[model samples]
Target: MVTLDWTATEIALSLGISPVGCAEISGYKTWVNVANEGLADAVDVGRRQQPSLEAIRKLQPDLILTSRYRHASIARALGEIAPVHLIDDQENEDDMLASVYQSAHQAGAALSRSDDVARLLESFDGEIEKLRTGHAGQVEGRKLVVAQPLPGVPRLRAFAPNAAISGLLRKIGFADGSQMSAQPFGFATVDLEGLASLENDSTLFILGEAIPDDLLHASLWPMLPIVAQGNVRLTGIPSWPFGSTASLKHLARQIVTRFV
Candidate 1:
């Protein structure tokens, strides 16, 4: 099958089914550099915004899976090549994990691997339980804030309670540490000043890249408790936040490695 959604590709990879082709295969550092380590044979169909129809025509996949959030606009055109399946991420907006679970089921049914998806989900649950029990004391009353600094912008995109990352953090026993209110779409833009308002006991989980070198010397940087106490942690994995059970387990393992 052809995959336009990174999350779908991750799910397929987790199930040990290598896709025929994928979009933006060589562009992303995490997806190419880290995520695609063992699976190097999938063809690069093209970029996400403008997938090459000619390249897709050569493969003639049985079906095409596209993300409603990212590839809805091209669904009509893609349908001409093969049947298009849409992963509706917006269906269960309030519960990110459930949304991912449903997506896994959808993909599994489409791929005729429902049993494999079930086993993967069961493994994910088991892994989460192990972390929850092992770190029960360490994370009981702890608070964490997940943030990714916007490129070329002097602001951080804070993941709110509604975000998939925030839900995963909560699953591991961390409370939402941001002072700002949750947004419908699960993100809020906060400058350094706004980040300073989090609780002193709160830890910060930085994603994508390290805190900018220049930000380290800023006058306000040292004022944050998480910074002063060295509670700030970075997730080095280049996985998508809006992903399946496999992604959650990958993220949970990262957190356990850093904090447990």
Candidate 2:
């Protein structure tokens, strides 16, 4: 099997299937940051947008998995090399968790790992339940905003209610506090002033390896209620907000241990 989508790559790795080839391999390692060992021996097919057709043709995989959003234009081209399965990358529903489950199942079915996928999802549900029960007293219904401050910039990308990360947080009893409307890609770019509109009681979770000093010293920073009240949390852990069930489980554990 070969995968051109990072989410599909994650699902394949979680199911113990090492793909023969993948696109943007290093990007997946740096962003997704899960089950990377499975990709150790996999060949890099090339960029996600314009994969090296020659390289993929050489691999001659039995199955090829890619995102409908990214590969729809090249579906026919990819099909010539192997059976192509397009994975829906959009979270086009009210329930992002359900979207994750459905994507996992679709990938599992394509890989003939239906039973493994079922167990993976069941375990994910169990983990979520444990966290919900354990943290309900403190986190239940508490509004939270998740965002990543762009390095060296005043703007940050805030996750909307429909984002996978926000949905996972919801499962653990936190309510989305982002003031922005639901976006198709699950986040919106906003400046400090935009974030200041959030409710005072909302907890702000910042996702980044390191907070920029400029942001901390920005004139508007100290004035933000969430910052003034010490309700801001800096997640120094590197994370990929958009990922599969395995990545979500990994993030859930980190959230419970470090942020909760």
Candidate 3:
């Protein structure tokens, strides 16, 4: 089998299928765990922007997994090689966790591993319960702002109330501190001043990388309540904020690991 989408590859691997071919970008360190375990012997299909059609044909995979958002246009061409299972993310766009599970179930069904999907979700639930128990006091009635600091850029990518990360944070017991109006993509650009406007008790979840030193020492930085209270949590774990089950699981684990 071959996976043209990174999220699909993650689900496939969680279901115990080692794809014969995978898109190159899916092998990044953000997905290191899955790549090392499931893609150790997979063929790289070149860059996602310009995947090698010839390489795919050489693999002769029985199935090609893709997503409607990224691969709908290529579905026809990819179908010529094998059956293309397009994972539609927009159907459950408003509910990211549901969309993730739906995508996982789709992959599991295709791979005849629905049982594995169920088990994975069960484990995720258990882990979440543990995290909720462990951080019961810190998160109760508390709000948080989950943002991605764009390296070299002065602005931050703040997760809107509709974002997947925001949804997860709310589920784990923190309220959304972004307080921004909802958008289709579930994110808004904000500067330090914008962040400062949020409630002081609101913690911060900075995803992907740490705040650059210049920003850390900025005159405005010390003024933020989170910074003053030492509530700024940095998660250097590379992850797709809008990713699938495995990525979500990885994120949940990172949160638990950091707090514990």
Candidate 4:
């Protein structure tokens, strides 16, 4: 298996598959909680933008798979060493589901629990429908404003229009109050004052690892209306913020059930 992002790597491990090797953006470990599996022995080939070709050549993985949207060149470079598959991420519900199923098709038998995958998907669909009906009377069809605490970086990072959270929101029929739309995987910076000025209620799905104190009690956060009013839903997910198509469905369900 081949992966270019933390989410894909996490998915591979969840599927009971391991890459002969892989790469990601620098400091991946800084944000993602490394799973206890092949990742223990897996080599960090290089950063997403610049993977070490020499290292990948040494690993000589049988097949490489990458999200088509994130690292095209890395996928191409990996292809020289082995067969590379670029998994596409789509916006619409149908296209997104196709992207996921297509990913399962690519995984072949590496997925240890095909039954689990199917069950998770079904569960997500069922919960989504239930939530849609369950909350109709109280939610007033609110939209979600997904945000994440920017540690050390002096600004707030909000999900762009097409990031993972945004995609999931649209999937579950939440109104898209998307102010940022140029990217499928992107973050835009905001100051505390700026965050207060933005007035889209809906739900706020905050992403990132579980650093509660930095996020919850930080001086900048307490003043925000979203935080003060309990409108923000903080989700303790990894830095890459995405995973296998099936794994993503799990994340999607958790987001909707918790925030929607």
Model 4 agreement with the true structure over 94-138: per-residue lDDT tens digits = 234445555554444334456766664566567656656666554
Better candidate by TM-score, 2 or 3: 2
lDDT values, one for every candidate = 0.75, 0.84, 0.75, 0.59
Candidate 2, 181-236: lDDT as tens digits? 77868888878888789899888777766666867888999998888898877676
- Give stretches of model 4 more than 4 Å off: 24-38, 74-77, 90-140, 170-187, 208-224, 227-230, 236-240, 246-260
Candidate 1's C-alpha runs over 4 A off are: 27-29, 32-38, 237-239
**At residue 54, what lDDT does model 3 achieve?**
93
How do the predictions measure up, each by TM-score? 0.90, 0.94, 0.88, 0.66
> Candidate 1 residues 218-238, lDDT tens each?
788887777898878888855
Q: Is candidate 2 or candidate 4 better by lDDT?
A: 2
Candidate 2: give the clashing pairs. none
Off by over 4 Å in 2: 91-93
Give one digit per residue, the lDDT tens place, for model 3 in 45-135: 9866567889999999999987777888888899999999888654565666677767777877777788888898887778777777778
- Alpha-carbon deviation at 32 in model 4, angstroms: 5.4
Rank ordering of all candidates by TM-score, starting from the highest: 2, 1, 3, 4
